[model samples]
Target: MSFPRSATRSALALAGAGVLVLAWGGSAVAAQQGSTTVEPAGAAFSATLDGEATFETGPITVTCAVSASDPGDGNNLVPDEPDNHNPEGAVGGPINAPNFDDCEADVPLVDVEVEVADAVWDMSMQDGESAVGTMHVPAAGIVVTTSGVASCTATVSPDADVDIEGTWTNGDPVSSLAFDTTAPIEVEGGVGCPDDTEAGFTAAYEVENADDADTPITVGP
Candidate 1:
């Protein structure tokens, strides 16, 4: 999916409106026992980068100054089955493709470009006191292209799907979805890029109801 760019936006301008929802809109029925649900189901959301997005592979670092989760698709939180441990929701993908802008490499004169894959990769959201969602790019993973003084290709391909971990605050859907992981987002590179797989990615986003900005998504069971 092409990430629809609406001029350049700062993550601050649209904070408190970020969430990854199941692609297949679900019923708002109360969650079943033992099921972790991202509540207020059947709603879409808006998300802005809580801060700058960063990707690092050893000494090389790339940062995006802005990013947003595209709006639409009636995305919402379904009950249980997101299996935060496994990171697989019932079906294909989060509601929108996240878009990034003003990305630059920390290395002088080197430029950075990132692209999320186009295939359907399942996502899993789980509630553990707070909330956690896991996502994985298709086999292609997320491609980071570096150009300018030098050019290179790097891919952050997780061996398994539904594995990128994102966390939400306890009962605070308005808080940022924390995407910093204990483990690096493992990467493989070529053409002057690092040969080892020690890449890391981190971003924070706040989620709000697309239909009702004042309403925050909640977790149940």
Candidate 2:
């Protein structure tokens, strides 16, 4: 679904608004109820994400291929702890490339990767329903780098949520993850854009299994 350019910009600006809350305030801790085998050490579990995503600057209409990897312990569905200030909620390693373009163009705007530090999601589950929660990256946490047409770098502070209703299963069998939020975020600094510009960006991620292997860990029923 395409969003109007005006709305897209508004959402993006709001996406990073909560960097302070995430950094100082604490998040709800997830209760643990089950046990699952952890992934092997040094093993990187990843998923292939292909979906329609819109950014504040422009429309990402291309069917881009995105990948997220977790180098830490295997996925922890019911994280022993789900607080942003703690380690429990910090599960998924980091999403390497959240947005990219394979199509050709004069400017060839592509290769937009947002590096999330110690990325993690707080998930809640229900029967026959996809899990939902917040995806947090700490203070001064996100760095967005773009290549091709115009090269630029943006350092962002973001606090976003997993858009529950949009979560669903893809060809990967297991359900995919989707997140969105429009909080007041901060753009610490950036290149290419005007100085002192508090550029806002609404971010969404649709992650699916990139391989046949079992999901690093399981969540939900």
TM, every model: 0.68, 0.41
lDDT of 2 at 178: 50
After superposition, the stretches of candidate 2 with alpha carbons farther than 4 Å from their true spots are: 1-46, 52-54, 58-64, 71-106, 109-115, 118-130, 145-152, 158-172, 180-221
Candidate 1 lDDT, 136-217, residue by residue in tens = 4455445555444334454555454435667666335474567765232343333333344444567777777666766676
lDDT of 2 at 95: 31
Query: Which residue pairs come into collision in candidate 1?
Result: 17-46, 17-47, 17-206, 17-207, 17-208, 18-47, 18-206, 18-207, 18-208, 36-80
Q: Residue 99 of candidate 2: its Cα lDDT?
A: 24
lDDT of 2: 0.32
Give the per-residue lDDT of model 2 (tens digit) for 1-221: 11111100101121122111111112232333332222222233343444533333222122223333332234422233332122232222333322233322112324455445444432332223333333443443445444443344455444443222223233233445453323233433233332222322222343433333554333433
Cα error, candidate 1, residue 108 (Å) = 2.1
Task: Output the TM-score of candidate 1.
Answer: 0.68
